[model samples]
Target: MSDLIEVRNLGKTYRKATGLFNHKEVIALARVSFTLQAGETLAVVGETGSGKSTLAKLLVGIEQPDQGEIWYAGSQINCSEYRKTNQFIRYIFQDPARSLNPNQKIAEILHAVLRYSTVLSFDQREQKISQTLRLLGLLNEHANYYPHMFSGGQLQRVALARALILDPKVLILDEALTALDPSLRAQIVNLLLELQQNTGIAYLLITNQLRLVRHFADHTMVLHRGECLDYGPTAKIFANPVHEFSRKLINSVQY
Candidate 1:
């Protein structure tokens, strides 16, 4: 149960144009710190504009932090280092259709990622692709089909297949379950838990879904306006939220 990822005082800022020649700095995240352990799911919950996505971006190296450091496996990493080392960490987007290529077959889409991320031979790549597809409840022949041929749930599984194909130590899911229906969401959540149990891959679940946070996450971190409002064991936070914002968020959930 060692720490897989540690983020310390992480901060990001963006400049937006106020006028023709005027601009203002927007604090997207400020002094956010958290630790994700091996084989654990850390749910990040927040309202819109609360810096959840910004935190995910920084975690996966999609954006550079203006301040603070990110450490993976005991060493600090800069943007460039993260780029090279990112095979150990993978990102799954909310919109599987958009994240996938319309022009390529599913096999081709997976092959592209495998080809660039690993040195597996063609035959090895194909076998790995088939194996991963089956793991996600997809058939080998399904790889010949296009992204448009699949439903939203299937497309999300395809995305998961691609992400897991890398055998990453960490998976950053940015609103990845939001697009699915309730039943599909439950299935995916169960699938995620099963995957973690089997592979020991840690998950950073960036979501606004408090129910998922309660069910799937071992720990929960609450963010508001680019700062940490509350963070602790998911059960404790849900049962008795210490922060007013956390209480409001939990109360706002319809179920």
Candidate 2:
């Protein structure tokens, strides 16, 4: 059980203009550090503006960190290199419908990822697409349907399919389950667990859902104002949070 992803003293800052020639520097993340083990889920719980999204963006190379380092598979991840070889780590956005192209059919959307990310032949790509569709419980005909034609759950499955098409070792789920209803959320959570069991893909789950964190994550990290307030096993942390902020967060959730 080696770590698949590691972050060391990670920090990020954003500057906002206040008045003419004046600016305010806001710390989006400050010296945050954690490790995601292979085949394990690490939930990052925090309120809005706690830098959860910022951490996700940095992990997926969407934004460069001002300081610190990220290592994947024991190799340092250069932001520029990551963008070119990002098949190893994928990101699934919170809103599947918005994340996907509304105008493109499902087949087109998936094929675009396959074409750009891999060197598979046309027939091979088609076979891969079919396989992914089946794995996600979607039919071949669903590929011809637009994103708008599918239900929220189905659209999320499609998004998952797109992320998995590249055979990534890790996934950054940025509030990926927040938009779904309770039943659908449970379904997706089970699906994620099943997928991880089968493929050994590690997950970095960023969300404020305490129930989901307790049920789905192996470990948890609590953030407050872009800093880590607590980090430990999910059960232990929930049972007895050492940090005041972590305790408050757990109490805020309705049983």
Candidate 3:
């Protein structure tokens, strides 16, 4: 399979005020490079402030890198140009409450996305929405309620449904399941696997959960201090990690 996405020598820096008077430059990503083959799911694991989110932002074109490049398909994408074509890339954020609108009913929310992406008539849109909702284990009645009316797990399902409704080629999940209860997390993970199997969409899953990565990811990358300290097939990396940071991360996973 050809590479669906390629990131090369990516770097980003943030200027910060030091103490009360001086300025400091914080490097968020340093010479990061990787590739995602079509339909492959890659998990990136790191502690907080490890630049995982920064990398996600860059990949999704929310932030421009100071150095290097990101190529989607065969072309190097200009940030703005990429955003214009971003229908193929969807982001599932960490907080469902914040990601969803409190005022919009689930039906309205999904209708808007379908309206934007496809030219389906009202009846077709409703049919699609109903099928998508059921696929995510959401009841048809729930679609008439506000976002706040649902549990955290249900809200996350809504988020996933919204993303999948677009039929995106790639989905970036930034700690999306971390906010859910453990059993709910397991359900969502299984849901993700089912979606991938059915649709063959690529996933750039960012998480702090090593256990989840072990169970769900095809490949895993360990980030530390803005660099990829280790990465490989999930099974091999977990079985014999060479880097101390990677070892610590693998050990930290509960059971």
Candidate 4:
């Protein structure tokens, strides 16, 4: 596999009102660096304020970094290039199907993406929708159903279908599996692994699920209070965490 995404010295800051005439700069993420290879899985783990979401936003073009360079498929991109980046790197919100339109059928929801993102005609769009839906183990008929009609596991697949519909090269899974029960999470994990095996779609799994990271990720990035505390192979980091904070984090979870 070759480098698919490269992030160098990424940083983000936010200004919050502190007083009547004063504001404070809160560094959400700073000096973060990493690379993701084609078909590779990189798990980003951190606490609430560790800037995991900030990193996800930057990757998907939802937000721009204050300082740093993001390279995709060997070319550089900034916030303004989000629409272009979006076609290649897709994001799935943590709320699962709730991110979907309650009033729209699945087909309509997916059709909207194809209708705008590509020039595919109605027939092509319909064909692509069938293929994408089936790719996530959903039937074509389900596309006509509303999100509320599906079970929790099925809803997760619908969300996956939305992201996969674009045929994106990379997926920024922004804690997408957090809400699923363990059994459902396991099924989704297996499905994702299968997809990666077949499609070579890389994943930037921004999540707090260390167990998932330990078993599923090729590498792990540990973030703490807007800083990268440690980063390395999953086995190496789990067996011998370099930083005290990292050790504490690993110890917090049961193997």
Candidate 5:
């Protein structure tokens, strides 16, 4: 399989605020490199403040890396460059409340995205929106409901449906499943696997869920203090972790 996403010598630093003149810099990601092949699912596992979220932001062009290159397909995209057909690189943020508009109905929210990003006509958008909602196990009756009216789990499903409406080639899910219950999480995971098998879409799963990583991810990368500590096939890495941080993270997960 050809490489779909590539990162080389990636680095990000945040400057701390100072009173008068001098300020210190906090490094988020330091010299990180990896390759994600087409149709492959790579899970980025890390604890809080370990640069996992930072990596996701960089990939989705939310935050620019101070140093490094992000290559999609064959071209490199930085904070300044848009990936080839970049709109297909969809990002599902962690917080449903924050990422979604509370004032908009589910149908309205999805329709707006489809209208702006897709070329589908009004009738086509309606049909596609309804199909996506059903695929997510949501009914048309819930379509007119505002986001705040739905439960957390429902909001998450809606969010996933919105991402799918674009027919994305690469889905960057940043802790998107963390807020869900275990049962719902399993269902969503299964849905993701099914979608991948059917569409050949790749995923950059940014999560701290170690067990899920072992089960669903083809490749796994562990981060600590803004650096990659271990990366390899999921089974091999978990079966015998070479890095101490990887071992500890695996152990920390409730089995």
Candidate 6:
């Protein structure tokens, strides 16, 4: 698969209050770059404040970058507006419980997405909703239930269904698995890999979970203090890390 997403020279800075009238510019991400192919998983591992979330926000247009170019499916997107990438890129938050609307039934939630993103008729939208729910291991009956009715694992499946409904090219998971228990996380991981194989959707998994990174990621990019410290195949990074920080990181995790 060719590169489905290309990021080049991305940079982001935030200005925060330092004193009464003073502000300091903090660089959250700096000239970071990478590429993701169709059906591939690129795990971005970094400690807190390491720019992982910043990168995710930038890619999804939650925040505008200071300097960078992001190309998705061969089209350069305006990082300032999420609508520009709505059809190709989607984001699944860390807390699946909170990502969904607690007030809306699952069917209503899914229908809203279809209503805004597609031209499908009401019947078509209903059909698409059932299809998407089933695709994510959810049932049509569950569609009548509220987000609160499901367990943590089921909530995640609902969230995944919401994202998959769009047929996105890349699904950016910002610590998406951290909130789940190990068993659920493993199930979600396997489901994600299966979805990748079946749908050819790329995944950018941003998290500090090294175990997940080591096992599932095709390539891994390490970040430290907003800088790219190491990057390449997961096997190479584990067998022999290039940066000392990476060595320490890999050693911190078992297997």
In candidate 6, which residue pairs get closer than 3 Å at backbone N, Cα or C atoms, i.e. clash? none
Better of 1 and 3 by TM-score: 1
- Ten-residue stretch with the least lDDT total in model 3: 79-88
State the lDDT of candidate 6 residue by residue for 121-151, as single tens digits: 9999999888988888888899999999999
**Lowest-scoring 10 consecutive residues by lDDT in candidate 2?**
79-88
Q: What TM-scores do the predictions have?
A: 0.97, 0.98, 0.93, 0.98, 0.93, 0.97
Q: What is the overall TM-score of model 2 with all chains considered together?
A: 0.98
Q: Residues 86-118, candidate 3, lDDT per residue (tens digit)?
A: 778889899989989899999999999988768
Residue 135 lDDT in model 5? 84
- lDDT tens digits, residues 43-157, model 4? 9998999999999988887787889999998898966788877888999999976699999999999999998789999999999999998888889899899999999999989
**Residue 89, candidate 3: how far off, in angstroms?**
1.3
Kindly report which residue stretches of model 3 are placed more than 4 angstroms away from their true locations once superposed. Answer: 19-21
Pairwise lDDT winner, candidates 2 and 6:
2
lDDT of 2 by residue, 179-221 (tens): 8999999998989899999999999999988899999999999
Candidate 1 lDDT score at position 153: 87
Candidate 4 regions exceeding 4 Å error are: none
lDDT score, candidate 6? 0.90
lDDT of 1 by residue, 1-255 (tens): 668899999999999999999999999999999999889999999989999999988888888999998999999988678766678989999898998989999999999998888899999999999999999999998999999999888999999998999899999999999989999999988888899999899999999888788889999999999999999999999889888999999999877
Find the 10 residues in a row with the least total lDDT in model 6. Answer: 79-88
Instruction: Itemize residue pairs with steric clashes in candidate 5.
Output: none
Q: What is the C-alpha lDDT of each candidate?
A: 0.91, 0.92, 0.89, 0.91, 0.87, 0.90
Residue-pair clashes per candidate, as listed? Answer: 0, 0, 0, 0, 0, 0
Which ranges in model 5 have alpha carbons more than 4 Å from their true place?
78-86
